[model samples]
Target: MSCCAAGAEAALQMDGIQPVSADELRLASRDLGDGTRQTDLSVPGVHCGACIAAVEKTLSALPGVESARVNLSMKRVAVKWRALDETPPDLIGALDAIGYEAHLFSSATDEKDPELSRLIKALAVAGFSAMNIMLLSVSVWSGADAATRHAFHLISAALALPAVAYSGRIFYLSAWSVLRRGRTNMDVPISIGVSLAVGLSLYETYYNAPHAYFDAATSLLFFLLIGRTLDHVMRERARSAVAGLARLSPAGTTIIAEGGERRYVPIAEIQPGAMMLIAAGDRIPVDGVVVQGASELDCSLVTGESAPLRIGVGAKVQAGLMNLTGPLTIEATTRSENSFLAEMVRMMEAAEGGRARYRRLADRAAALYSPVVHTLALLTLIGWMVLTGDWHNSITIAIAVLIITCPCALGLAVPIVQVVAARRLFERGIMVKDGSALERLAEVDTVLFDKTGTLTLGTPRLINTGEIKPEALAIAAGMAAGSRHPMASAIASSTRRSTLEQRSFDAISEHPGLGIEARSGNDLYRLGRASWALDNGGDEADTDAVSISILAKNGRILARFAFEDSIRPGSLAAVNGLRQLGMSLGIISGDRAPSVEAVASALVVDDFRAGLLPADKVAHIAKAGASGGKVLMVGDGLNDAPALASAYVSMAPATAADIGRNAADFVFLKDNLSAVKEAVDIAHRAKVLIRQNFALAIGYNAIAVPVAVFGYVTPLVAAVAMSLSSVIVVANAMRLRSPQAAPAPADTSAVSGVSLRTAAAKP
Candidate 1:
């Protein structure tokens, strides 16, 4: 029967099952801005690419539906549609027509992981039954008499029958559903093979025949269930990165009530303009401005940077940051749902959805596999019947062919490797946001780096402290302490003054983008741009340094405090390592030419561009790609966000700006730049393992399929061969867990204890 006819018949048969209504689906969906509504639904039957194609095609054909994306690893489909014209019931009906059953996905609905637990239980039952059935079959094969052999076969059948019914339902239900809709999947062949083996064995036993396949049918389920369980476990591990991020925000926050009393309230109850108390060692619950107190925040979750940022009054603190020092009183600037952390989670989900569009190796093979396997099996059966005129023998060989060519190894080939590689990267403080990141990372031939936050520590430090007198430095620091600009902060930190010295300066006022000014007795002091402080009359110092802030009193220069962003530790080693791997390196920076040159020269990078905007950085990446280069862009600022998303592959530090981290494919923790090299090396090795897995899967089918077609292999032997092939593929993938260190650089002198300073000096 055609799929449409079968689907209509199945719909008739499903009279007892209640269909989900439009109102119900609407309630489940969340508005995704711009008139789009999206909802995630659990799709249990989606095992391979064919399922993905079918589900997407069916739902996307609905009116007002914009897109339907399936994360096969998660067994969840995210559908987006125009809210004004479409409803959830419409999409659900389309899925039903296509043989898939979906329900609104809720993580809190189940306490334990229901899917994993089910797989484990089914595997246990299959394993136990297979062992007992095989033992009985061993007795029957030991040359027992007719009556004794029949008794042994009956005993084996009793154990195998229930086991198959219970454990094999996972495949049988999926196959039946698809077949009822007039389509086929990997489960179709699997269900057919298992049913035939068990049915034929039951008939042969009842008729007192010489052979029965009770052991073969049960053993196939045992091994196949093992593969299914492992696949589930790997997917769960891959999903932990997002889950870990979600756990960083507290569910409730301590709010400072109107009467000065503190009360704990759920995150939802905390609104914009609400004041909250964030104590040390607690995660900030909302995006807010610090109204009181001082502390350092561990902002790695937001920026991907390892260093803690010092926050004082008026400083903005985002949700998901851990307060590391004193308590802070903050007024919430945004609701919990719209906080920066929530935005990061949304970006990650969207990026992962995009990544899922990349077809897996297994799925690509399956698209070509289903038709060929069915045709070959059918041809083998017909050929045998024509040659020998024996229907029974022909059907037996055909069943063996189908059973042996089950795609078990092919289905497992890519996902297993990805899971293993992700786990290894996770251990090294790197989180891979998508499965395709490793593949894309492996192909990158050029590395593009941003100067600030990417190569440098991103924190400016005073470089000309020795050039100023102690009294001048103290006055500058006191004035600098009144402002929060990067240069001012550097000067303030470099010059520590006693409370008495700070008290000497009064009436300090900050000039935004220029500098800070203060009055001490009769002298008016200013520390900022030379033009602003000295009115351009001061003698100009000729230098190539990128940033220079001047300090003056009464229009006379006192001292010039030059600031430079220090290079991160291991940057030279990382650059050298990439060079050793034959990767072309370059830098694109918004900083002035001198500072950019200083960093590029320090790392021995020759290709460099300075003073580029975000769009220009993107154009630079595009130009490299146009020249046949696969670029890996590493950056950590709001300006770098666009370029990060545009690159072939991207990495960001944990301390990167929210948008930059969101756009990046991988986020590495730690202050050392060596993580970049480590990520690349791991990706290369992972690709190697993925290729080996493909080879093993294909090679197994090459040798085993012919033997089954020739009728030289029984169902029992075919089952063993199929199981062995999947095991081999998984074993090869496990090799990715071993350490894959980048080659050490030949020279460590520049990388070790090197201080980077701009060439220009201020007089």
Candidate 2:
């Protein structure tokens, strides 16, 4: 095998095993530097908020397990414990005891998810059997003689026995696994209902009874399978974001060997201090500093800013960013496993786990559903036996109760709405990461914004280009163009019209953290920091003005170029729309007070905090929450990550740092800030629809449960009613998908002035 292929195989093999001992697990785990060891385990059975809660609770309750968090989006559980006290085998055993089958997690196994295909096959079998058995049942119901009914029932038994046994294994296996561990989930009751229906139908067929319930058992499986299939498909779709991100890093990179020879090597094989060459359009393979060459890198993935950042010698470049303009030689500072991209993945997973702690409305109902359903079924059996003294009839009625109160509608309620709402938001360039984010967003009464990238075009623009003479500008641009720095690029771009082919300098040099200078005809022309270029380190008095860079020829100051972080298009309108919605808007930033206030004034935001650290931002959010304010934080920086997690609901630009985006509940793709407003509006509409769905589910149960208990519903009627309730709930959720119901598109004009070229570079 090729070296890269072998390296890939090694990585997969390391994570592919089911760790048999604590020592084996330690090999796959990381020391978090705080006496805690963390490992990720693939728990494919996690499907809903309840599953998240169950898995976390079960593992967390174990001795030596400090914390166990499950990321529903990834279907992975991250467990942390002291290495001295616990082992991987102990935790795996705990998960198994709680009915969750887990294995060491690896990205290589993501494509091998079998649940969707399994559910689809089960659904098809159940659907085909249900239709065939129903046809047989219709003849028996139409006043057929005893022998005819018996023969039809016999045929249905022959068909449904195998079909239910095969198609119903999805529920049966889960129910049986949990029961063996002496625990119960929603599937346990469902398994009991299916088995009882099939068993009773078989008994009636044996005795040649007048009526049989072959149709009910088969039909129930078909409907339940349909729900499971839809749920699985939606969850699969939700996982695409993380999958897409994982594909951003290059499979291999060209690294300089010990003898200065270049060879293509897998990212896993590159170590710290290794030198790698990256050409234009290649994603960086590791976090490193540029040692040679210069380039404009698309750093949207790291800073959440769509602007391409110019980098040269001494500039740091992170993995996952594209080398947009030129080739670069870099010295790797970290291995691929500990690069910025990998850290982002870890941060996202951790943030998602924290968000998963929010319980959905359906889960709350489910907690009450299982005990209520079992009690009602028990009472029905006892009451029927006491009144009629017929054990067979009583057991039949009790089975009816269990099958009737299957919670099909309750199960469909939130997921259907979430699926619809998520689709709608996706169409609007908004991605909802968690199921409960919409609910939390609907409660946000206050909105907080980060200054630099969140509400403005993060690229600095030369606003004072018109003030300098064309010839002087030409000299400065020529000197600045030699270095791929942000300020240098701004100066070069602003002076593009001042180009003079005849004015070539002899040599250009850049001073680290200072300025650039070029030698022309025995005189030095400089473009850089005002003090460094002018040879005077005096503070400028005009604090509110944009930043200035000095231009000098042979120690004589020629001009100063001013730069500003331009406001994003539609920022004003987005802020206005949020205010019009009665949400209080404010700004919190780590920038200088003057810079923050300048932007805040232009946006008409009066409530603002400047020069705040990450902890300070979190403190502000906590104080707001204490005052009963539901804050919606919108930011796009590593520093904003903590504040994002602290808010009631949070959003980040797609260009945002991986940590920031992962911390946010919602991520908007477009450059427009109007997405923030649209997300909130959709959230409000979704909340209404969700409540309506719950009412429909509850109203159906309130009326149907009593009738089933009173013996007014047969097994067949109960099955039909359950299917109808589910259908009704799903149909109501579909309303969110309507075009007319969508929030009006944000004004495109709001995104003007910031050239598309700078804003279009996706991470």
CA lDDT, every model vs. true structure: 0.77, 0.74
Per-candidate clashes come to 9, 5
For model 2, the superposed segments whose C-alpha errors exceed 4 Å read 1-19, 30-37, 47-50, 85-89, 109-113, 248-250, 277-361, 415-437, 465-546, 551-558, 588-601, 606-626, 636-647, 652-670, 727-751, 754-763
Model 2, 1-763: lDDT tens digits are: 0000011122233335354676778877877777788888887666555566678888888777798877655678888877543444377777766667677888652476566677778889888989999998889889889888888999999889888988877777666655676766676677788888888888888899887787888888887777666555655564554565667878889998889899999988898999999999999988899999999998767555678888778777888999999999999998877786776555444433443222355666665666888999999999999999998788778877887786667755665566566657766667676657787888889999998788876776777777877787777777776566667877776755444532479998888767887898889887766566765653444424556677888777888777766677668778888899999999999877887777777778999998899999999999999999999999999999999999998999876877898688888767778788778887788778878877887898899889989888887777777777777776687777523332333434333443222111000
Q: Pick the candidate with the highest TM-score.
A: 1
Clashing pairs in 2: 304-655, 304-656, 569-750, 569-751, 570-750
TM-score of 2: 0.80
Give lDDT tens digits, candidate 1, residues 1-763.
0001112223334434457678888877777667888878876667666777688888888778898887765667888888654544377667777787666776432256766777788889999999998888888888889999999899989899999998987777767777777787777777788999988899999998899998889988888878767766766666666566677778899998899998999987898999999889999988999999999998776545679998788788888889998999999998876786666554344433333222355666766666788899899999999999998788789889988997767766676677677767766767677668888898999999998878988777777777878888888877877576666767776754333354357588887766788897898988876777895655445346446777899978988777666788778878888999999999999977887888888889999999899999999999999999999999999999999999999999877876787789988767778889888988898888878877888899999999999999998888888878877877787788645554444433454344445432221
Q: Candidate 2 at 748: error in angstroms? A: 6.0
lDDT of 2 at 528: 67
